[model samples]
Target: MQKNGFPLDELDFAILSCLQKDGRMSFTVIAEKLNVSIGTIRTRVNKLIEEGTINIIGRVNPAKVGFGAYAQIAIYVRPATLKDKVAQKIARLPEVSFLAMTSGDYDLEVDVMCRDNDHLVQFINEISKIEGVYQTKTTLYFKVYKYAQPDLNLLK
Candidate 1:
């Protein structure tokens, strides 16, 4: 892992990988798997959390949780200087699962999950009302085959 420029060492990667698989996995189990002391695991985990390198949280399936409408929206922002301001407004929307500024025809891209098509429509209307929003193209996702976190092994 030292070969890479990333600050994380092999042990850190190993610990993150284990937690990625199961956030609730015990430090003792990780210690046993990685052949490290429980205290070492605890200390490393605490450091990781403090540094904001990792977040331990329960992930739920949006569909299973009553979010039936999933969609991606590409937004065109006028007066590009207000891009950051617009992004801040969109980010505050509870229905938005992901949002990013992009270099393309669209100034911003956002993913949202809603309870139904009506809810999606309402959400879109809400976004359109924000300042600097010129136009938006939304695509509905009927079925999502894969939704997950990045694979840590790839960083190795």
Candidate 2:
């Protein structure tokens, strides 16, 4: 399927690679790195925002955010209404951070951060009500060893 929102180009990808590493980096700094004018950097950043391809926000580490638990839930859906209404509801829930619909043993995978066991239980109970959802298997993450954005170096 053709995805909507910003159609990324090489320069846009370069800008994103830089900003993803440090969201607070200024336009002047990015312009220097990308060998583009400061004006160009500003335009690209604004376009990214307008197209909904980027949101410059402080992405809190779960530990710092007081999320005592992080879990992944795999959900199986009925054949009738796969990702339509069900995924929409999951996306709106406060605890849900990352959601992806996939073709495999599970129809969807949802990542959630919770304050505690009670919070996790509550989220699980509430999210099950999403239409067309049939079953779910959840796995808690104990130690987050590594999480990194792809380095642009390898793409060279």
TM-score of 2: 0.83
What's model 2's lDDT at 128? Answer: 79
In the range 73-100, model 2's lDDT, one tens digit per residue, is: 9999897466777988899999998899
Off by over 4 Å in 1: 1-6
Best-matching candidate per lDDT: 1
Residue 155 miss distance in model 2 (angstroms): 5.1
Candidate 2: RMSD to truth: 3.0
Worst 10 residues of 1 by lDDT: 1-10
Q: What clash pairs does model 2 have?
A: none
TM-score of each: 0.95, 0.83
Q: What is the model-wide C-alpha lDDT for candidate 2?
A: 0.86
